[model samples]
Target: MEQHNRFWRIALLSLPLGVFGLFVIWPLFSSFYYSFTDWNGFDANYSYVGFDNFAKIATDRLFLQAAVNTTIWMIAAIVLPTALGLMLALLLDSRVAGARVFKSIFYLPICLSAVIVGQIWTWIYQPDWGLLNTVITQVTGEKFKYAWLAKPDTALWSVIVAWSWQQTGLSMVIYLAGLTAIPGDLLEVCEIEGASPWQRFRRVVLPLLAPSTVVVVALSVINSLKGFDILYIMTGGGPFNSSDTLAMHMYNESFKKYLMGYGSAISVVLFLIALAIIGLYFRQLRKVDRIYG
Candidate 1:
């Protein structure tokens, strides 16, 4: 029996381990190697240029713009979704009527596809005949048309808002779970002490939700870095690439412009950033674990 059990254990572990190595590990190393080359993706013949791709990225104007936009996205994803989700969680956690219905309504966006959300928002932001313009005109009794997606200034933010709306539901669900985990006795103690609502929340609640906050922040950062599908479907990184993220820049470079090596370098940089964030997440988790213990 022991021998049979050992065989099965090794077989189960080995299968997954082999698959992970073949798929995940192989692609990562291959991409890293390609980042140092001048391969046009299809060409069998290419030069091994040491850090030339990386060097070019430093002075690339399009890349700089994408970087800035991605940074903005990261900040907005962390701040907006977290704040809004927490507030919704708090509201729903209270003794309110139709809480389940309200939760479902807020979480509905998360179930929709990014492509669908992008397409819907695109129509909503249309200048002349869109919903937003129609409402504005109705309110002010003047036909005020604004080209939201077409403009360089407002394009990135418009997409960010759409993305945030989708993400808010996920954040709210996570926060609700965190809130549910809090002990009733702990809350009762605060009430018994005659602690003000704000004081109790500041002193007791926020500290307890630190783990959930870490998870939400990490997820937001990763999602922001990987933002592509919605932006691609909506803008194609157009309007002079104002709303282009690093992922979109990589796609445009590799597929559109046939600059595979340069795109690979960008991917490598993005991968490094994600890896750093994950490392920080683990470090934070360890600290939180220690504190809770």
Candidate 2:
């Protein structure tokens, strides 16, 4: 009976495993292989370039801009969502009317696909009659028609705002779970001891939330790296490539420009960056565990 179950288990896993290998693992290896070649993504003929692509990366001004934009993207993505979520979690976790309904409303975005979220925000940001502009016009008593997505200066920030809106709920839910795990008795003690709200939050509540913060930050990091689809839909790295992140740049180079080899090199760099960040995060997590545990 045990052998029969084991065979069934392997059989059940085999298809998904095979599929994963074919799609994900194969593409990853292909990217690495092509990174060292001058393959234009078509034509059987190509040459081994051996770090030539990497050399070009050093002097490519657009690459430098993309790198800078990526850094800003990651930083803003991590900070905005995490901070706003924590605030919302704190607000909604308290005894307020319709808290449950509010939580559900906030979390609705996470259930929607990225495409849907992108579309919703795109409409909200429309220049002429969009919700945001309309509100601004009403408040300022002027006809506001500034194109949020088309303007180079504001495009990246506008998308960042939309991203924060979608991601904040996930962080909030995680933080709420963390808050619940804190002992009510400890909080009661603080209150009885006449500890101010800020003091209790700083000296007790915040430290207890360390685990949740770690998880939220890590998710923000990974999600920010993969936050290309919405940008693609919204701006396509437009207005002189001001909003072009590393991933967007990679896509443009690989597919649009048909510079597959150079794009592969960018992908490799991005992969290394993501790997290093995750590694460092896990290392710090271990240290935190040792100290806290």
Candidate 3:
């Protein structure tokens, strides 16, 4: 009976495992292999020009810029939404009036696809008559037609803002859950001990919210790493590559420019970066679990 059970379990798992290997594992290995070659997508013939593609990275000005932009994006992506979400969670958790309605409004964007959010923000940032500019124009009694997504100076930051808006709701929700899990009795004891609101929040609340913060940060890191879609839809790494992240550069090289080998090299670099970040995160997570346990 045990043998039969084990056989069935393997049979049930085999299909999904097979699919995962075929689609995900295969592509990943292919990327690594092609990174060593000079494989233009259309050509059946390619040369194993090893390390040449990787060497280009040292002198590639655009790649360096993209790397810098990606660094900025990751930092902003982690900080902005996390800070905003925590603030919102604290506000709503205080039994604010119409909290449910506000929560719904804030969370609505996260439910939408990145493509949809990009389009919505695209309209909002329209230079002439978009929502943001119109509001600014009305408030200042002057024409405010600055193109948010069209100019190199502001394009990346603008996309970052839009990305933050979409991500904040998820963080807020996670924080809210954490807030609810805290014992009201514990907070009452702090109040009885004459702890001021600031002291209580700082001393008692923040420490208790560490677990939630970890989860929020982890998701932020992962999302920020993969956050290419919204950027693509909104900017396409345009305005002279001002908003190009590593992923965008990879896509442009592979698909648009047909430099598949070079693109794969970029992908390998990105994957290693992501792997390092995630590995460090997991190490910290283990420590947290041990402490919190």
Clashes of 3: 0
Give the TM-score ranking, best first.
3, 1, 2
Residue 174 miss distance in model 3 (angstroms): 1.0
Clashes of 1: 0
Against the reference, the lDDT scores of all candidates come to 0.93, 0.92, 0.94
lDDT of each residue in 63-177, candidate 1, tens digit only: 9999999999999999999999999999999969999999999999999999999999999899989898999999999988999999999999999999999999999999999
Q: List the residue pairs that clash in candidate 3.
A: none
Between prediction 2 and prediction 3, which has the larger lDDT? 3
Rank the candidate models, highest lDDT first. Answer: 3, 1, 2
**Model 1 residue 122 lDDT score:** 94
RMSD of every candidate to native, in Å, equals 1.5, 2.2, 1.3
lDDT of 2 by residue, 1-293 (tens): 99999999999999999999999999998989999998998889999999999999999999999999889988997799999999999998786899999999988999988778889999999998999999999999999999999999999998888888999999999999999988899999999999999999999999988988988998898888888988998888877999999999999999999999999999999999999889978987887688777
TM-score of 1: 0.96
- The 10-residue segment with the lowest total lDDT in model 2: 284-293
**Model 3 lowest lDDT segment of ten:** 284-293
